[model samples]
Target chain A: MTATVIDGRMVARGVREETARRAAALTTAPVLATVLVGDDPASGVYVANKRRSAAAAGIGDVHRHLPGTASEAEVAAVLDELAADDRVTGILLQLPLPGHLDPARLVERIPPEKDVDGLTTRSQGLLARGEPGLRPCTPAGVIALLDAAGIGLAGRRAVVVGRSTLVGRPMAQLLLGRDATVTIAHSRTRDLPALTRSADVLVAAAGVPGIITGAHVAPGATVVDVGIHRTSDGLVGDVDRAGVAPVAGAITPVPGGVGPMTIAMLLANTVAAAQTREAAR
Target chain B: MTATVIDGRMVARGVREETARRAAALTTAPVLATVLVGDDPASGVYVANKRRSAAAAGIGDVHRHLPGTASEAEVAAVLDELAADDRVTGILLQLPLPGHLDPARLVERIPPEKDVDGLTTRSQGLLARGEPGLRPCTPAGVIALLDAAGIGLAGRRAVVVGRSTLVGRPMAQLLLGRDATVTIAHSRTRDLPALTRSADVLVAAAGVPGIITGAHVAPGATVVDVGIHRTSDGLVGDVDRAGVAPVAGAITPVPGGVGPMTIAMLLANTVAAAQTREAAR
Candidate 1:
């Protein structure tokens, strides 16, 4: 069967439009404080893209960059200020900050209501209890893609490759919330291919290029690629598209599959963050 | 191959002796407060057993029951008072309260620092993040029992049936921490027998009698029964003990296997709470 490509860009555009409408409806623009510490070009580009996206979604209350040498105490203080500020509805801390700053401590400073990235301990607790909250963007994007692909999660077998807190762990919990039978696999896992073959739905989040191939896919399975790698040739996903496409009933293409969905969910979370803060008021 | 019969009562004595030794080393006894709502005979019996166990462990400061008609606000106030008091190192809230009461809400009210049962969202978050914190009793007890029975969790294939927050969910997390390849099975799980046949360690927390049988167990698989049923046949575990024993390497008996271990861990948590509070001072 020919694999149906999941169109993340189009879905993201639709999401952006909705966010724009929601932003316009509010008296104040939904502000997202973007904290970027280091001059890592990639991080800079990513942060810039987010600022543009947030602006496009009508999020105009922009708070930007801090120097790489900023002390941990200073970063935490900024987060605390943002948390206390009634004007700022969302906080986005650019990751891979300087070696010295404690990301967990700084991230925890973002109030649970304004934690659009869903990185706070409170957010984790809410998700663990299967309660509604602003969920982690990337993991939430995978679910959004699954929905777009018309995959039924109830009673389905899902194997998530990688067990990172940002991806695999939350993804498994999200799947379980939808009543899917979920299994989490990591580097320490034994017989990886054997475990992969049993999955009716496979989500590869190991961040390694081409770790999941055609051989690992169960025939007629829907595979969502969560890995992104850049090589001299081009970009690649965990799954080898050419090798796995033939066997997969429906598969998400690397560049277009899960990527755009992440941005879409980020917009969604920011809107959700706005609503959460609003609801509390 | 015959299943090893894990003696929970014997293990409990060992744990109590250790607790006693720790108490002797301390300048003062660890104080634990027990909060019981309503006079359900069964709940009263359970609380009484906990108090007796606490006494045997040389634990002190037992607080008596409050009334059944306690409002949520009232309960929260009481919990808040206990949490603020330095003398109370640990707190226990007996279950199956009045019909109108929300158990989750009440459990959430207990300060994570004083929650010996480890039922709070904070504790669950710590578990998810692989941080060291008090764990839910039955799940923690399961690991302790396995350790006492000479079972090392490294490289084991563990299958946990059911996913309740108290038992199965935390049980899976603990097993994963121990380096076990864990799979959480639930009501929606298909081909359970096939899955169970490959398990090296099986835990049944479905609260259903005889859900796991000899046929489901792989030959010489270690089984830990978490379900306790009070049927016409008397108290029984989720496993069909007679049929499963011959094919299993080790098994925990229903009434004795995991039951005593729960209270043992409770005592352990209380003592740890005391140490933590004192150190904080």
Candidate 2:
């Protein structure tokens, strides 16, 4: 374990403290509207964590939980109400909705200013245009982690595995925004190892557990694992930690790395929305 | 000169013919509202060509020419009028407005539904999300050229030089959408030749004449030159045509390449916008 573990928990704590300080200075307290459509146990836990973190950061949390069989219209109605609410500074729509619900339509209902999760087309569009707006939490968190580690992205070769709109795509855009020569590789990419080996900064986000090994990593490259899978033993990431740690320069741990940073970024976005709304007013 | 030249003019003719057929079949005649805010000779020529192309494609062209001293507010007013016009199927705002005007604000004035250039935030957002919308002209033209050449983009290593929103960024996104391992290299990127040499498909869009030579290109790679520089020695492209022809499997020329295809895609977008508007009605 010669590689330095990027301590996301420590950095996340710093983020929350700074967010709390900023929230206290605001003339109006920020309120986050959280909508959970189904009773997926994992989603429930995730929502609960966010609420708890919001409170700890001195922000108000407004939770709306619908039945598991809720229709898309029903969910959209909730989003519309939240969007029009003057008290709500940001909105978080818990993912993995019931099978029948159209998540895209529901996400579109949240206005770009209040979209804390940054999943709406407008937020993605703003990002694509390199405009200042609420960015996706996980990818933004990765940026914070890299900054915390004092890693420079400019002119570096960044290779991202995965192309999900939620993570990989936005991640690549963020890297590109910072002037990194970015390459996005997916399941269809040929000679994956050769591509990975060429990266100065490698981001593993394939969601498949233990998909990246030492052979797939470049020597002295910084690896940020964005995938997390929980099994009976414990939580694991997309990268083979034991195999990659010896070969990599820096690696993030599964439980404490990107996971904590995501919650922190959500809080940061909520505060930012509050500030932006206040300024606009 | 073993490389096959990608014939843009012939392909553009095919495209215009198809668009004319589609326009003729429409219940209502498609009308394009073009706003030219400056007296720049190049812009004037570009706008004139666009109108001529629109007529050839059986689409009505409505030209609104403003003086060089026109205010941003005035240009925006014209866009607003076009946006509300029931007969207007698509809106085109010519580039390089007056010195006092902010082009971004004026461009945003055109409603997303009628933004034929695909430069609006909403249109860009839709593309970033991989949703169906009017795409940028030049990048869409590049995709059309590739399809016409019987080149498969999926699983290929595609390298794009330059990161201008007009060409490189959107081009990378289009390639990525087609399952290609996409890389974006800009002026700030390190080791340009090494990076370009690794690509299966190379797109030169830096707007610099003769920036990419044979040594910078991978042998047998398909090269698309988006830059068109008018020099004393006639027109040239970003890729060194004479130097790269022997190395590349296929290449596009400066005069007959991307230049013709851009107007073709614009006509295609106008027809597509008309189809979408009619469907909504």
Candidate 3:
């Protein structure tokens, strides 16, 4: 029997619709500010998609582009300006800033309230402590997907195969917060299959394409793939979908699974930031 | 085969000696300030032990005691005063403050540099991201114990049976940082033994006395018991020593095990905080 496909686009659309409702409810529309450091084609496409999505969700969009040779101070100045602007509700800094600039230092400059991507140290700390604050979008999106699918996490054995700060680590924390017994396995893990097979809910975020196949999954277990790689064989995810789908109970597909949910959650965070700022005012 | 008993007192002595040397090397003596609210006998004993250990490690000690009726603002004022005090190298606010007062709010008030206990959100964030910062003492102590025992954690399966902010959560992060495959099981976990028996290194911080027995251990696994309970039979930890010792390769005993290491690490953090402040100056 084949597995039930967890459609991310459908869930993300529901999220975007809810976000639009909230955005419309606000007297002043929430604004998402995009900061692109270089002219990398892929980064440009990603930024443009986010801006268009924000607009569709009834959120205002403000885009700032920096030359490929932009200095750290120049980027910092732009962030400082957006951070101080009353119209800007949330800030998304396009990543992989030319190799010369430090991402951590620049990301920390975005005020935690305005950090829609939730990459700031302050935001990370809030998530670690289970405090009420913006969370990293991808992991938050994964949670939204799971909730929409009606999967119960409490008392479940959830294994996250990857330990990235962005996805794997925070994913484990979110699952743990939901009362799932969580395990995090990384590059140094021993007997990878033996560990992954014990998972009732498996999350693959190793950034390595086709790393998890049928042999690694527990029979009838729910699988969530968080990796996306452009290969000669078209786009592929961390999990080998064809091999694992028939064995697993449910699985999220690449491109349509975790990808769309990310931008959707960013819109939700933007509206939440606006509501918080307006409440404080 | 009998398990090797990890000698915490011996290891702690060495740590304190090294900490004293560092404290002496600093131009100014590092000072640890303890804030105790209410007069709980157990808390008083805990604070006294820490203060005594600080003096033994060549660290200065300052103590403040508030009556049980103290308000939240009163505790906040004390933390504020200590935060601004140039002489206070580290602040240790005794836990279990009056029920009316909020510990999390007060803990956040202490500057991250002076937060020796590492209970603040900022410290937790730094740990979650694997950045350089002071970590929670108990987990840090457990790591030191494992290091002193010459147990290599890389590529090992380490299961932590607790999800507490002070110990369990940070313990998993520390193990993950060392490249171990880490799993955190809490009360909501299914089949505790099945999950725990897979660990090469098992940390029992469940706060339940003798909850783990021989049935829960794999042959020749390293076990670190972090619970301390006073009972009719005497002091007992989360793991039943008589039951698990024969099955385990190594184990830390109660009372003289993790307890001594906690105070030792606090002293070390005090010196480190002083060193950081001095270096910045």
- What are the root-mean-square deviations of the candidates from the true structure over C-alphas? 1.8, 1.2, 1.4
CA lDDT, every model vs. true structure: 0.85, 0.93, 0.94
Q: Which stretches of candidate 1 lie over 4 Å from their true place?
A: A25-28
**What is candidate 2's lDDT per residue for A149-248, written digit by digit as tens?**
9889999999999999999999999999999999999999999989999998999999999989999988899999999999886999999999999999
Question: Which of the two, 1 or 2, has more lDDT?
Answer: 2
Put the candidates in DockQ order, highest first: 2, 3, 1
**Which candidate tops TM-score?**
2
Models 1 onward score TM values of 0.96, 0.98, 0.97
Better of 2 and 3 by TM-score: 2
User: What does candidate 3's lDDT look like per residue over A1-281, in tens digits?
Assistant: 88899999999999999999999999899999999988899999999999999999999989999998999999999999999999999999999899999999999889999999988877888888777899889999999999999988999999999988899989998999899999999999999998999988999999999999999998899999999999999989999999999999999999799999999999999999999998998
Per-residue lDDT tens digits of candidate 2, residues B1-281?
Answer: 47999999988989999999999999998999888886899999999999999998899989999988887778878888899999999999999777899988888888888989999988888898888999999999999999998888999999999998888999999999899999999999999999999988999999899999999988889999999989999999998999999999999988999899999999999999999888888
User: How do the candidates rank by lDDT, highest first?
Assistant: 3, 2, 1
Q: Give the worst 10-residue stretch by lDDT in candidate 2 chain B.
A: B68-77
lDDT of 3 by residue, B50-111 (tens): 99999988899889999999999998999899999999999999998889999999999999
Q: Candidate 3 chain B, which ten residues in sequence have the lowest lDDT sum?
A: B115-124
Better of 1 and 3 by TM-score: 3
Q: Once model 3 is optimally superposed onto the true structure by TM-score, how far is the C-alpha of residue A12 displaced, in angstroms?
A: 0.9
TM-score of chain B of 1: 0.97
Q: Candidate 1 residues A146-207, lDDT tens each?
A: 87667999888888888777888889889988888777777777888888888989999998
